[model samples]
Target: MLVWERPEPPDRPVPAPLSRERIVQAAIRLADADGLDAVSLRKVAAELDVGPMRLYGYLATKEELLDLMVDAVHAEIRPTGDGWREVLLSLAETTRRAAHRHEWLADLLGGRPQLGPNTLTGGEAVLAAMGDVDLDVVVPAVSAVAAYVIGAVRREITERRAERESGMDQRQWQVTHGPYLLRLFATGRFPALAAVVHDGPHLDADQTFRTGLDFLLDGIGARISP
Candidate 1:
């Protein structure tokens, strides 16, 4: 059973009683600082100054702890806006920002359906804002937006991490690698690509994401009923 579904143990009178929240928070701190690989039951227990075995009473496995951590982050995604599109846009933007804040989130977003309270609450808000559309139509619409958000957020985070590690922004990287690409373009093998690279608008990451999301919403709007 999921940790949330399990009954909470009664509070003990010990100097520092172990709880699921404390354990998950400690693990998140570790992950936020050193990435997910740094987080383990043993390490979390040690962070709390307890033995590893003490954690098993609160969590069954490391996977359960991860689920809790992900859900905890989802709590940060608050949906707002007057209409369905606005609400979805807000959801996408906030989720993207959250993933950026917690870079490790890119590794786990959309990997599975999260049924934690916060996730379910967010979904409830979205669905409520979507009005009374049929499940057949509404489900796909929401799913499409979700898929786009997940893919875009993951790609953005990956690129951001790459830039950070390589010590070069996108323009610098392009300039540094321009020679090889320019040669390929000059060969007339990628005339269409060359034209875009030479003439296309250079949008920052935020602009790119917003434009893509607007395009997605426009496409979905055309397909769904008024």
Candidate 2:
């Protein structure tokens, strides 16, 4: 009779129900709104009207959350079946654009490469694009091309962020810095750079990405065939 009351259920709090997909989507939204640094189990839980501990049901740790967020962004870039070269170029540019849009994406490493689905997907796409070429040459060649594209994109995104933060859009930078650049070039110390950057042209990232990809592939072909 003394034990029949069930101890009033111990007055425990009810844990908020959560799912992997839901948590991932919420984290994506959080990242989209406030960049990668804003996303955490506690932060997401506050947004989701739950406690931080609840996130463990879906994501084990903060690192896991970061991995999911990056992959989610990667999932947005769809590959159209053109040729291998075209597809790879498109993928490269697409990745660049996405990283540009979400500034934090360029820096998300997820500790290890394999844990991140998007990173793996992108790597696979590069391999697939080079599938037509000799594996030995094509693999290294595409790797170099991908590295260039990523480096360029990272630089571009960083510059863009700086411009946005400083209230100097591309137009303003060109208007203000164009003269100084020309003046410096007129000094002859940086003749080649000055000529390339004369009057400051905006880079067409898409065209640049494709052209570089082709150049690397051509080199690979030459090495393989010769």
Candidate 3:
């Protein structure tokens, strides 16, 4: 979440002071360095060398700041894209990279996305890419890819953040606690999961994204063509 306050442009008459853009950029930097929870208006003001109350002219609330930050990150993904498939693929990859860069982003950006302009435009671009396909495949295709990407990103970010936050890497984590999870899986209801539990992080997000995307495309192709 982000914390934003109004900026009083009239009260703080500075000699070339910080712009809203600058404030947001500062916020982004703060977020990148200290994680999202650190992005308070006071902290942002501190980063910009200004009073906390002086920031009120730009944004109103924490939710507004978060929305702007989300939109800002979305804007960074490059709105311009090529053809439909290329566009969607680029969007997917761009989103994945963006989320990966900010490990706390995925949970903040859940599966059911908000209708911010950037968010809507990004979705429109994806749906437009499958322009030739019928709604059936197109709808499922979009949802599947989106859902898969969100899930992949969420899992990746949370795991890495947890490991980093805990000061323990996966190997030690597995060594200490894998047995309990293993025991739970030993009941035979989760054979596939059990098989992978011992294997470690065999497939990080890149492979998983590609695999799920390919699976969906293949299925769509089969259904539509045959």
Candidate 4:
């Protein structure tokens, strides 16, 4: 049975006034500071200055707490306008921004089907924007856009994390690696890759994301008639 299904003992003394919101916020704080692995019921309770058992009143399992955290962040995604394309773009950007604020969120992206209320509401906004689009393609289209957003954001986070660990910014990393790649290019083992390394622009995070997103959206648009 779910935690909510369990009833309080009639004679049990009432504990401190804690709520799910408070617990979830504490978990989010822990995650933001030390990454997702840092968040635990015990840690959250400590953060809240309460005993670990006190959290059981608000949440049952760690998975439920994680679900709540994901939903809480989903609440930040507010799609503007009624146009399906615009709404989708807004959703993607909003999600990216949220991930920026909560780097640990990258680990959870697309890892599960978040069924929390706020998550569903954000999804509803995407579908509602689709309007009269063919039902057959609506879900697929939404999935495609979401996949792109999640994948792109995750890549961005991974690269940034690598940069942080290596003590090198993007430009510095490029300069460090570029010479070795050029040497490999001279060997003619990877002509195609050589061409890219030699000719391709070293786009910053925003440029790389927007370029990929535009391409993804354009491909999706081809499937939508008119």
Candidate 5:
């Protein structure tokens, strides 16, 4: 029989009561303030005033930490409504507001499959709202809603960021660029463009988003019972 001595664990002093939630929160703050690139194990540890290795105990890698952060925000989405349409609408609004508050969220929206407990809870809410729909159709219906939410929110966030950085709102952007586009129309090669640009009503971002949502929901409503 061979005998070997067991090695002792590291003898460093105890870390400040670390937890996965706490670690994720710290990372979120960094992301919120400085964007997602600013979040790193080293940076998170520095924010928490502990060694990086301490975070390793809670999250195995940066990807795991990011996943936790994404789910943490998903927990903020609270959908309340009487039926599937209302529920999906509420869900879309909640997700949009969350993304508005945390623009970095747009960076990861729909980038990966969300599998955390909080993310699962949000999905469960969508499923419950779906009521007695056929199981086969339920997932597809939910997925369509989710796709619309993510795609629309991502575009909204991106345009918002561009507006902020350019010091111009969407309306201002159209005003500044609309004339140039109109010039091309004047050349007589694009009568359709000229007609639309000349006659179309200028829509604010909210109107555009809401109208698009209604249109999408109208299509989805056709498939469901109610």
Candidate 6:
């Protein structure tokens, strides 16, 4: 059973009370600092200054803890705006921002069905914001935006990590590889590809994300009955 579905243990009188919230928070901190691989029941117990066995009252396994952590982060995604498009835009942007704040989130996003309280609430808000659309339209519309957000956020985080590890920004990385790319493109055989490399807009990450999202929304708008 999911951790959220199981009722939390009643508070016991102890020098330092240990609850699921504390356990999840400690796990999140470990994940935020050193990525998901760093998070474990043992580490979280240590962070809380409790024995590893003490955590069993609140969590059954590491996967449960991960689920809680992901849902906890979802609390940061607050959707706003009046119409379906505007609301979905808000949801997508906020979800992206949340992933940026918690880079480990990219690893867990869309990996499983998240039915935690906060995730359910966010879904409810998004569906509610869709107003009176038919269920088929609303479900697909929300799923499309969500899929885009997950894919975009994962790609953005991957690039960001690569840049950090390589100690070079995107432009610097491109410049470093310029000679090889120049040689590859110099061949007259690849005209179309060379043209884009030489003349592309060179948008920053945020601009690129927003632009792609807008294009997607426009396409969806065209399909929606007015």
Candidate 5: list runs displaced more than 4 Å.
Answer: 1-15
Q: State the C-alpha lDDT per candidate.
A: 0.88, 0.69, 0.73, 0.84, 0.81, 0.89
| Pairwise lDDT winner, candidates 5 and 6 | 6
**Native RMSD of candidate 3 (Å):** 4.6
The number of the candidate with the highest TM-score is 6
Candidate that scores best on lDDT: 6
**Per-residue CA lDDT of candidate 6, range 46-161, in tens?**
89887898899988999889999999999999888988898999999999999999999999998879989999999889999888878878888888999999999999999999
Candidate 5 lDDT tens digits, 157-215: 88877888999986798889987897898899999878877798768777877898899
Residue-level lDDT of model 2, residues 21-98, one tens digit each, is 567888878887778788889888888788887666555678767767777787766554555656666666687778
Cα lDDT of model 3 by residue, 1-226, tens digit: 1222343355345733866677778888888887888999999989888888777777777666677778778875653466555665677788888987765568677634565667777777777766677897777766766777788778778878888889998789878988888788978988888877667577755787777777766676676678
Q: What residue runs in model 6 are displaced by over 4 Å at the alpha carbon?
A: 13-15
Q: Which candidate do you rate higher for lDDT, 1 or 3?
A: 1
Clashing pairs in 2: none
Q: List runs of model 4 lying over 4 Å from the truth.
A: 1-16
Query: Model 2 lDDT vs. the true structure?
Result: 0.69
- lDDT comparing candidate 6 with the true structure: 0.89
- lDDT score of model 5? 0.81
What TM-score against the true fold does each predicted structure earn? 0.94, 0.77, 0.76, 0.91, 0.88, 0.96
Q: Poorest 10 consecutive residues of model 6 by lDDT? A: 7-16
What's the ranking of the predictions by lDDT, best on top? Answer: 6, 1, 4, 5, 3, 2
TM-score: model 2 vs. ground truth: 0.77
Each model's Cα RMSD: 1.5, 8.2, 4.6, 2.7, 5.9, 1.3
Give every collision pair in model 3.
5-56, 6-55, 6-56, 6-57, 7-55, 7-56, 7-57, 84-129
| Evaluation by lDDT, superior candidate among 2 and 6 | 6
